[model samples]
Target: MTGRRVRVAVTGMGVKCPAGNDPEDVFRRVLHARPTAAVVPGLAEAGLPVRFACTVPEFDLAPYIGRREARQIDRATALLLCAADDAVAGAGGAVRGPGHRAGVHIGTGIGGLPGMEEVVYGHGERPMGMPVHTVPKSMANSPACRLAMRYGLRGSCMTYATACASGTNAIGEAARRIRDGELDVALTGGVDAAVTKVIVSGFARMRALSVRNEAPELASRPFDADRDGFVMGEGAAVLVLERWDLARRRGARIYGEVAGYATTCDGAHAVAPDPQGAMAAECMRLAIADARLTPAGIGHINAHGTSTVLNDLAEAVAVERCFGPQSPPVTAVKGVTGHLIGGSGAVEALVALLCAARGVVPPVATTASTPDVGALDVVLGAPRQVARRPVLSNSFGFGGQNACLVLRPAP
Candidate 1:
């Protein structure tokens, strides 16, 4: 790991998403474009205009950690801990080799809004008397702090909160550190458990939520004619990253290599992407160049198709501009997973790695008729078997934050 072209291997991945609880299950659902959005419990009675969201069902944290321990942490932290456990276990156990050389990186857009809401609203009347663990639970750095404590990682424990781009930035930064020889291993990803009424009400008030209460499953139809808005989702995804040479020496099961990562900002809008997509396309170009590969080397794209008109269209224009008319096959996992906000990028990166491992492209879950945004190839109906090549995943967040990563099959 000497030059800027140092390779970072994705040895293992662990994901808890709306599509499924495990990586394999999630990939299967992704390939077929299965919809997972459903009415959130109590959302209908809560009087919020938006009623549906993609919620993880009854995640049992018992096997991963004790009940008492789970009670102390936030739901976002709990999800990250579970995903990290799976990731570490998949990579052949805990940090037995040079814990000081390892690190933790996680991203969350809203941190522990669910916990804060419960503490504030559940036990009313006493606004001043909050729980002692409130700050610990609600802070954005809790996941990273808890992960570092859990695995004894002493190097660079950090958290990025760039809205939906948080996860992508976390993974990118981790890969960059390892590539630059700052660390040998990093447990990096993102998580968000912000499906609370406080969170839901805010989005609903902004009118950014879908009002398809009767048809929750069809609410998140990205790149579709009838698409209204994105469906909020909750989940976590963590990837085990190591130096490519080290991974090979250890005989770790390498899924793919984090070949390149780049981030840019539109600097034009607070919540909407640039209609021209110049900045987004430039970000993609920079990521491709960082990988030391041309755009022709890419075989597929995991897009940030959040089902919203602004995001979907802007992303489409960007993809088309970057790769020209014959763009690589593109798929939006959000149609099924909904928009996981901070967790979306890591999960999409996992999807890209899985595609490289399996050589199959997933479909854009809910779009029966593709929107007339651009001519880029949008995988639909069913999964496409591809001749394994490099894949690029994109994530754009509010405040004009944009991040892109290029992933190549492990050599």
Candidate 2:
């Protein structure tokens, strides 16, 4: 299967987000420029420092998930399961092929924190006082394994843990497998339910949190001059990537084609983005080249805008250096969704794919006006309708991990 142009295409997608628990709903909300992040319920009463999060409100996954399965799988994994179910459903149920031809690749920032905390409280300092489900729930790959097992996917199954880039890494890796003929189809995404106090306190300790108790909904202001650190978010997004030939053979609807992917390491700082943005620029360059296209061909960019001061600044520099002046339309969804961390990239994938398919660029639902920092056509205030071309989705994570993927409307 090596060097054999496997023709990767996006067949389906599902998302559980503040705007909506379903992809259509999320698309509609984003298209209309709605804000979802708010003061998380119960956080104020708990006396926590940070107050806002992009919480999934009134999500009844029971309608989509089984009861027995719901009881054991961690909420993080459960979120992935629910999203994967939606994607597979969008693909018209399962593929009519060998189960081994399908695969699962999941990413999670902090897997099973809810269940692990439960175990810690339920069992004290005694040795080996872990529940049977503890190990499975705590494993970062638990969602990937469970998705593969449930779907009977025997093809390559794996998970990535590259912090914020985890989900993007999973999606990129899945596309790689499809491109290499390792699998005909794959379900890949990222999930996180790690809005725990520990996670919050840790970020707060680093002073990387938006202390906007007054206006929680307006806390996440990506690319805004007055932006603070990112607000934590929770949810999951899954996508079905199928070989274009197989999708055509099955008469499947294609959302977009994954044209290229690139992943790189900064090797500079463990927690901070490079001031020069060299690694980030190189990453985008590599992805654009991998797609066999020049940066001039890209029409839109779904940036890894986490709302942090350094991140937005560095990312803007990278995009400018890579695309030059009069760059593509860029919209940073984290302004509205907050920073979902690991799941951010996959959710951004949903936005980018839709941009490529529908020929419309969603607006940046920011609290304040977007800063005029770079040479980008930053979409704001209103959605833009234009001919959608290749869209680049960027993801940069902790430990200086950078990834970019180019997707185009499936022809």
Clashes of each: 0, 0
Q: Candidate 1: minimum summed lDDT over ten consecutive residues — where?
A: 1-10
Best by lDDT: 1
Shift of residue 208 alpha carbon in model 2, Å:
1.6
Candidate 1 residue runs with Cα over 4 Å from true position:
1-4
| Highest-scoring model, TM-score | 1
Per-candidate Cα lDDT values, in order, are 0.87, 0.83
Per-residue error for 177 in candidate 2, Å, reads: 0.5
RMSD of each: 1.6, 2.0
Q: Give the alpha carbon lDDT tens digit for every residue of 247-358 in model 2.
A: 8888888898889899998899988999778999999999999888899888899988888888888899989889887778888888777877778889989878887788
Supply the global lDDT for candidate 2.
0.83
| Local distance difference test, candidate 1 | 0.87
